[model samples]
Target: MLGSLLIANRGEIARRIIRTCRRLGIRTVAVYSEADAQAPFVREADQAVAIGPAPASESYLVGAKILEAALQSGAQAIHPGYGFLSENADFAEAVTAAGLIWVGPPPSSIRAMGLKDAAKKLMAEAGVPVTPGYMGDDQSEATLLAEAERIGFPVLIKAVAGGGGKGMRKVDAAKDFAAALTSCRREAKASFGDDHVLLETYATRPRHIEVQVFADSHGNAVHLYERDCSLQRRHQKVIEEAPAPGMTDEVREAVCQAAVRAALAVGYVGAGTIEFIADTTDGLKADRIWFMEMNTRLQVEHPVTEAITSQDLVEWQLRVASGEPLPLTQAEIPRRGHAIEARLYAENPHTGFLPSIGRLDHFRTPSDIRLDSAVEEGGVVTPFYDPMISKLIVHGPTRQAAAAKLAAACRAVEVYPVKTNAGFLARCLADPDFLSGAVDTGFIGERLASLLPPAEPSERVLQAAANEMVRRAGVPPALTGFRVNADPSFRVPLDHEGTRYTAQISPGAQPSALHVVVSGRDFIVFEDGEPYVLTLPRVEAGPEGSDGDGGVESSMPGLIIEVMVAVGDTVSKGAPLLVLEAMKMEHTLTAPFDGVVASLSVKKGDRVAEHVLLVKLDPSEVK
Candidate 1:
């Protein structure tokens, strides 16, 4: 085995790799960007190296800098965890040429599956069941339109080298084809440096199922069963599970065999995943499955596979990279119980899932389950990388039990200051269709309303906040605001997400408890249970010409990527004014009302903090 290894990534995955290396007695070196200097992974490493600045393009994605760090740290191997340069074929080759063990598949295999168009052709030749798509080399718009016509309506336009929902569009009609194609190509070029796309028949109800396959230099490959990743939003997976629900014996055998064949065909080494889109229009069956794509590195959802198999996949990757054969034969690898994993992200579900960045004032996870995370209570989430905070995995004897446990776990999560998808994930787990296993890729969209319920703060939560505020103010009980009928009563108003709620508090049965009602919802409150709610003093509306009348402030801290307006441009409400890039995504700032731009304070390529004024508008009075 390699004596020392360098992790060419950051966040939880880097920490995850470091943990395994420590278990195997391998000294691990961690590389970090300026934004990640204080990251948990960097502190946990045996040695650390600073690559470059915060931006991925300048740091994590810079193959030369990462290689330099690895060599300088005396790391004998480089493990490119999941993102950034993990799937870059040239990086893998360069690592090998530098006399360092690359803890990943061969560069040839990565190249073989790098582009969707080429990989589809290869999969077809390898006897794997591939989706019927136009993978031809013709780049003409006319040819693409013709191919879409031939494939039928509702075809998918997917970028040849894109993943994670980038550069993908679904066209529902012929009239929308051209505009969709143009937009897709623009995004594809921006994301992958390739405007190439392929047309494929869109599955009516698809379940994303992938088989984990690992191979060794000895040409031995074995499948580690499958994971069902049907729950998704915007083509990004939200939840995943092992041993796909309702999977039959025959279907499992066929899919597992096909995944092994695909790995062997590429002469693959180390860990990889063969993703298939199974048409569940009827139900999961062998013939209904078709090849989607092959992730040429360890997957983010590998924990579900590990939970069921009781095998450390990272250890397997190291063993294979060290020239060891398959740890277990095809028959020897056993699948046990059911496992589910939910990706916790620093995003607000109410505002179109906008990425949230701030300090995690109180971050806690259930002690019973497995949590792979890099954040602490006082940690800060910046706008430099993916906003994923942690992954919560649970295992139970059956699928229902696992689902129940996971739902409870989601509710038990306590994240403060920065918003998270914990409540949203809990709603998904408790969804009726989800519980019945009748899920598809479109489940979240179809049930978005129920999933993101109205934020009606409970009476208890409001009273707790009011009580805390009173205690903090050192206000005497007899001095409660405008006492009624010789009794102490207080009305506390709190602002959350731009909405205000009034909490009516009075003395209750005990000194610690309080009788509280929030927005007419009644309940009793004590000091324990549910997390403390942040209470902000209500802001009284000022005159129309007062401060902040027309000031447009940034919702989050980010870099200004594009500015679309000038100092004197007249604009209507909701006109796109600028674009801010934050947490690896773009958010468009728009005009709040009909106004003329009186002053512009920012320009393209400028970094702004949250609540920073970007533009001031001179508003026109309305009738």
Candidate 2:
């Protein structure tokens, strides 16, 4: 085993690698950007080094600076955790050439699998079944359109480099193919710097299954079964689980053998993933599986693999890099239990899945399972990098237990200020269709409304909505001793999930009962220390507050992302003037009525507290 290793990444992945390193008695050196100076990973490492500035280009992606850190720290090897220079072939070569172990795959293998177009061609040549599409060198627009027409409609245009659904678009018709290609190319170039793309026949009801392959320098390789990451949004994985539900033994063996073959073909070393698109419409079969691109580095969902196999893949990587042969055979790796991982992102889920940013006033995730995250309660979710706040991972003896635990865990997680997809993940977990494992890439948008929380309030919410008035200029609990002689009721306007709630609070609106609403619905968060929240139908925001602020701002607590108009600019009735991306959805700040924008108090990218002044529109200047 290597004595010391420098981790060339930040956040949860870097911290994850450090954990395994410590278990194996490896001294670890952590490198961080300015933004991650006080990160958990830095504090956990044996030694920490400052690489560069905050931007990834200046920090994480700068291979030279990372290599310099390793050298200056006197580390024996470098571990490129998942992102950044993990897939950079040149970086691997430089690491070894600089007389340091790369602690990943051979540089040649990274080069072979770096580009999607190139990898697809190689996989096809290696007898691995590849998806039928245009993988040729023709970059001409007309040629791509012709290829799409040949492949039939509903083809996917994907970036040749990088994943994360960034530069991939599905074109259902020729009319949209060109535009999709242009947009994909721009995003690809901006994200991965490779505008080269490949087209594939988009399989209906496709399940993404990947094989974890490990190889050592001594020409030894083995397969670690498969993981199903079929439930996805924006082509990115949402929930991933091991021991795919209803997998046939014949197909499993074939996929594993094919993965081993693919690894051997590239002379792969260390841990790498061979992803395949499974057409479950005709049941799981070896013939129905098509090769997707191979990830050249450690995967984000590798923890699921570890939980099931009881093997530390990072330790294996270090051992392999040290010229150690395979410690165990293919049969040695055991699949013990089911593991599921949900990527918790700072995003809005209502209007559209837009990224959210801001300071996390309070973040409390479940302590029951393994959670991989770089952020804390006070961490800032910057727009400069990926908006993933954390990853909620759970494992159990059975798939049902795993799914149920994940659902319960999501509901219990409370992340304040910056919103997260905790509710969405819970809904996805509880979806009868999802629990049945009938999921694909378009699971979110296809069943958006059904999976989303209903836009209605519950009675318990009305009873506890007395505090909503206090938050918006109502009488405080300490001074609200005087009560009306009649019914003693007052309306507290509560807005959540784009709808308003008029809570009839007794004692003429006491300060204790605040409303927690979501999507035009109100829920009583049994602050009585209860587990579940009681919901109710929403009422209109009546004339309750002293201020003339008529606009229903943020219904729930979240961060505002984009302010679209200046003061006195808007004139339309419902034109979106500002965008509030909360919990992975975009809620537009629109005109309350047909009027002109009057008083705007917030700017773009400003983190506004819930119910803060977003935009005040004059309800008069209408026709």
Candidate 3:
């Protein structure tokens, strides 16, 4: 085992790796950027080192800075947790050259699977089932167009160099293929510094199933069953589970063998995942599955695998990197129960799932389940990293029980000030189709209307807000909330989510609480359960707050990555005006109605706060 190790990552993943190292008596070092100086991971580490500023380019992504931190901390090994440098082959080589143990697979394996086109060819040559795609070296526009036609309509143009759905697009017709390819290449170049892409046949109803494979330096490899990550939105996974709900024994055995074969072919070491796209239009079968790609490090969804197998995967990575053999053979590893993981993100599902940034006034989750979180009460959720606030992991004797438990936990979550997708996750778990295991990649999109219902503040919530206001004023109970001489039945004015409400709070069975009756529903207020924090509408008094004048505003705090309109340029209604990068996702703001661009206030590469005026159509008159 490593005497001391430095985690070359940040956030929850770094904390996760540190947890295992501590249990194994291995000293841990943490590297942080300026933005994360006060983060919890830094406090948990045995030693901490400041790498660079907040931007990832100057911080986590810099291999030299990470190496320096490792050396200064006397770390014998470096664990690339997952994101930033985990799959960077050159970084892995650099670490080994520095005489430090790289707690990941060999550099050769990473290089083999770094590019999607080349990796598919390699997998095919090694007898693993690969998707039919164009892996040719030609990069000309003519060649790509012909390949897309050959692959048939509804082809997927994906960047060969990166993952996380960054440089991927689906074109359903030949006319859209050219534009999609161009946009995909541009995003790919910006994200991975590679403009190359591959065309593959798009599965109509795809289920993302991946097999977890482990290998050691002793040339032995084994598979740890599979995880179904079909619940996705915008190509990013939302929920994942082990022992796929509808998997059969025969199909499971075949997929596991194929995964083991792929790992051995690359002489893979440590923990890795072989992801496949299952065409479940018919249903899961051995022949219907094809290799999509391979993640060359521990995945964000590895906790579900751990919950089911009752084995610590990070401990396996450490032992394997320290020259140990496989801890358990394929036959000896046991799968006792079902486990499911939901990615709880700091975003508002009611508002197109736009990422939210601010301080978490109240952040709480269930204590019974396994919650891999990084934030606490009063912590700030910056717009620099991924928006995932935490992951809620639960286990049960059966899939049904696990799903129910996960849904309950999500409902129990209490997050304030910053909005979240907790309610959406709870609805997903409670959906009948999801509960019955009839799910696919398109599930969220198909059932989005029902999942994101209109927000209606309950009477209890209104009463709580009104009561809190009175309590803050310290008014006597007899004189509270428009009370009369003797009657307690009175109307209390309150505001929440941009609307005003006059809650009628009367005396309750318990004098400590209030009874609010509205729309024939009786709601008893309490101090526990769902919080009722009133969000009074802000009344701005400057140019930024001007309304009813065709002034385009930024709805969130983010960086303006692309400005589509120039000053005095005419744009139509609903036309995209600019793209804002926030919380690790891009949001395109559009013109509210047809108008001319009279003035433009922001340009590309500018950081903006919420409600900042970006453009004003009637600027000449207003000024």
**TM-score for each candidate, following the candidate numbering:** 0.81, 0.78, 0.81
lDDT of 1 by residue, 1-623 (tens): 87999999999999899889999999999999999889899999999999999999999999999999998889999999998999999999999999999999999999999998888888889999998879888978889989999999889999999898899999998889999999999999999999999998999998999999999999799999999999998989999999899899999999999999999888899999999998899999898899999999999999999999999999999999999898899889989999999999999887899999998866778899999997988899999899999999999999999999999888878776678888889889998899999999999999998888456666666656566555544445444422235335556556544566766656551333532222221122311112334434322112211155777766434578999999888988778888866433466777777888888999999876545578787886432
Ranking by lDDT: 1, 3, 2
Off by more than 4 A, model 3: 467-488, 509-532, 535-623
Once superposed on the true structure, which residue ranges of model 1 sit more than 4 Å away at CA? Answer: 467-500, 509-623
Residue 482, candidate 2: Cα error in Å is: 7.6
RMSD versus native structure for model 1: 13.5
lDDT of 2 at 466: 37
Per-candidate local distance difference test: 0.83, 0.77, 0.83
Off by over 4 Å in 2: 453-623
lDDT of 2 by residue, 1-623 (tens): 78999998888888888888888899999988888887788899999999888999888988889888899999999988887888888888999999998889887898899888888889988999999999889899999999999999889999999687789888999999889999999999998888999999988778899999999988899988899998887678888988888888888999989999999999998999999998777778789899998998889889899889988888888889888998799877788989999988888765576888888766777798889887888778888677777888888999889999999888777765566678888889988988887777677769878765444645565555435423433244333222334333434444545565556555433444432433223333422112223333221122321135545454433346776777767466556676765433455655555677777776766654334455667777554
Candidate 1 TM-score versus the reference: 0.81
The per-prediction CA RMSD against the true structure, in angstroms, equals 13.5, 11.3, 14.4
